[model samples]
Target chain A: MQDIYEDILRLAAGKIRQRIRAGDYASHTAGLGKGKLQANIAVMPERYALDFMRFCQRNPKPCPLVGVSDSGNPNMFTLGQDVDIRTDVPSYFLYEHGTFSREIHDITTLWQSDFVAFALGCSFTFEHALMRAGFSLWHIENDKTVPMFRSNIETVAAGPFSGPMVVSMRAINKSRIQEVIAISRKFPLAHGAPVHWGDPSEIGIKNIDTPDWGDASPVTDDQVPVFWACGVTPQVAIEQARLPICITHKPGYMLITDVDDDAEIPVIAHSNS
Target chain B: MQDIYEDILRLAAGKIRQRIRAGDYASHTAGLGKGKLQANIAVMPERYALDFMRFCQRNPKPCPLVGVSDSGNPNMFTLGQDVDIRTDVPSYFLYEHGTFSREIHDITTLWQSDFVAFALGCSFTFEHALMRAGFSLWHIENDKTVPMFRSNIETVAAGPFSGPMVVSMRAINKSRIQEVIAISRKFPLAHGAPVHWGDPSEIGIKNIDTPDWGDASPVTDDQVPVFWACGVTPQVAIEQARLPICITHKPGYMLITDVDDDAEIPVIAHSNS
Candidate 1:
């Protein structure tokens, strides 16, 4: 199992996709395929494509849209070869008119020609880069989901897609704040740098212990909470718009891609050797 | 004489209209307002509005559209009070079917009900900031127009707005590269930072001294020629489209606005700051 874990970390897209397709492995894919890009998935009716695309354009921080697919074909050729959206992710959320309806492992039966899929860059890639660069992460150390909150910040309205931006919070020591910002900026497709830091109420988070989604984590006395725009913002926008139907990956389940993570240009010129 | 600069800048928006209405102020608007925003102007027929808008969206570095007025109406309420597009700009270049027809100081005679005016952010504001930040500008020091070149890099095209990008080059000492980037990024509406640095040939500039437009400056061995996307790119596209009639500011000539130069937020820090 240890040998398999090491090999999976370096596996190519085809092998990983095959494992995911066959249901041979079903755990969290956070560190799997170490350097490939991963994204949050939002599937919706084609009728809302224009409005949703505009929403992504207007609020690039929270919903940094990477690849938008043509109405209903599952193959995202731009993201990777033979990438099937219907069965790519480990899990999904089915929403109906702004409410949580249910969760499904596969949406192959629900696939439609009128559906559109938007792949948004996730923070996991940047988080990985930061850790490799020696920046410590509290949520990762404690094995908890990063704290998330609804902020007072308003997203630019696009047709019916309008709502407050949701952000993920991580506590970073003062000494490493610049290091974290430098590493994360490279992945603009990922949420990028912290939109807000220090005080939580400034962005409308009432309490640090309670989060709208995900497991809560504690903040140490010496650390300040750094907030990054989250991928979940688009999902929140879909819910707020009360679209008749929409589907998204369950909070932590993401669509892993073939794009090499190392392919990204680090915004920082790493300190000389 | 210096005391008159402010009064001249504060003329009743209506009175300014009268002089522009009468074909006065035919020179470039460089130092007219002293501390007000001056914008690059683009006038196009309504038929090409949406595509041109999308082109601006795709290529924001060169075309940071500040204000886009409604089709046919020359009055731009957002830009200034009683600001008439036909007469506000100091000079206009009329391009007919991809050819230069004539240069005119005012365009009331050529005004069409379907014409739309787009106000783009110019590099002048950022240049001012750079000077205040203590960076020396070679072209401005020499009292010459900044060097501009047609690069091999192609802009993302939309509809008829397809052409190679034009860039303005500045020679900066190697030690100040980061400082220049940090200062310029604050003004995104202005062309922002260099698209390419260090190697001019990498972006397809064949001769360092021979520019496609404007006078070239000498670059010392300790300096690198940094390039920023120029507003002239859209003009090239408009000329290529060969519409029956198109009007633009004659190179250096620009429209001075009543907006304060320092009024904008340098950095948007949420309450957390």
Candidate 2:
């Protein structure tokens, strides 16, 4: 019998995932799937799924859930009918009880009946929107990875998950700050508006140049360092959780989804009867 | 050690729950706890929780999550530091295998080790916003309940939950409909914007006078029937799922929460480290 993911993935996102799955296009996905949603992937056991789900719900900016695969199911039906969580991302990071273990391109060898896959919104969507509006990203222009930092902002914790939020830093010209805020705020699912913009010290970032992850994009005198919640924030919480085992996408290699970035995703209802 | 649901509830929401907790307030929560958030409650076993949570996530317009009680433990710490899910709401309807088994004011005796409680956003927040803005709601002025109906629109399914959307209707003057929409959009947690307005038939409502639930509020010549997704939509899906047991707040009985109607509600992130 034909599976649900048969036809839809042949386009942009599907083609990208196919390459990643075949180990052909194994680089970062920034600017890959134009106008399509890219997501940060997290896979874990069912027991921790609910708490993690709660954590995501509570911390939506950093963890806007695009789709959650059913326990034991590899197909991310809603995300892309043809996508499989196990092989779609370019690479995966295995975390064993909060400690980094190894990286692999495919989890087909480790698929488990109890695994639940979480696809979280990535800033690439809003970044695309920013560039479209004439805001040139420094890192994108320099061909450097976006700089990320650990902030003092404490996220509301759920069971086994609690920690300071990690944020992605970008230098926006001071005069266009409001316009950037307005543009980014439109995609709440894509980490939304910047959590901290002017002072890194306010969010407890002692040094602006030394990012905990990715390449540092220096803030010039003409610009202020704007920070948006990063997808890596969940990894911090997931680390604190120290689950027996957890899987996440390596920093820039996200799961490209067929879903549109600006679609008015239909919310649903129940009959009073 | 004192529990989390402490001094905070001494305010309006806290006091109201105290009444409902003591069986002092068993009536509908409408017009109560002004400026505070109210939620619809759903309780089921852990085995069914992930799917149910997905159902709510998929059908967010009718099921904007307010708080989800940790599995087994009854404290809805997020909703109220001190609220007990088993006894806080004024009344609950116990559904056994999709059948309305009975009504009860407390579920303490039936609480199980695997029970998970769900608190969903209610339209009252938007209604309160509408009322505060000086736009008189037909039902509020007449002291009638907001009318609800089963629409032909089907909800996106998750696991075992699937069904048509149910919506609550209000008569908005043609001139004020736009204003009402703008006001409600600000409260995304409270069902956000209206799904439909003007002609009821567009959404598959065959009759203008008869509603599936609540009191009928007529739309006059200058008014249009504005329909917002109703909280009852989950119950419709829950009914179809037919789990061994399920519990929900009776139509009008809701969980009054301490959260402000309009707040930034910070979203979260993780550290790459």
Off by over 4 Å in 2: A1-11, A18-24, A132-134, A173-183, A266-273, B1-11, B132-134, B173-183, B198-202, B266-273
Put down candidate 1 lDDT per residue, A66-149, tens digits, no spaces: 665656777665567677888878788999999999998788999999887888888888898888897777788887888888
Candidate 1 runs further than 4 Å off: A1-6, A12-29, A32-37, A41-54, A65-119, A129-135, A174-195, A244-250, A255-273, B1-135, B156-162, B173-202, B207-210, B219-224, B234-273
Cα RMSD (Å) per model? 7.2, 6.2
DockQ of each: 0.11, 0.25
Candidate 2 residue pairs in clash (backbone atoms < 3 Å): A5-A81, A59-B268, A232-B270, A233-B269, A233-B270, A234-B270, A270-B233, B5-B81, B5-B82
The residue-by-residue lDDT of candidate 2 on A180-218, one tens digit each, is 998988787798889989989999999988999989888
The whole-model lDDT of each prediction reads 0.76, 0.82
Evaluate candidate 1 by giving its C-alpha RMSD to the native, one decimal. 7.2
**Ten contiguous residues with the weakest lDDT in model 1 chain A:** A264-273
| TM-score of each prediction | 0.67, 0.86
lDDT of 2 by residue, B120-143 (tens): 889888888888899888888887
Output the lDDT of residue A106, model 2. 94
Please, what are the lDDT tens digits per residue for candidate 1 over residues B134-174? 98999999989999999988876656777888999999999
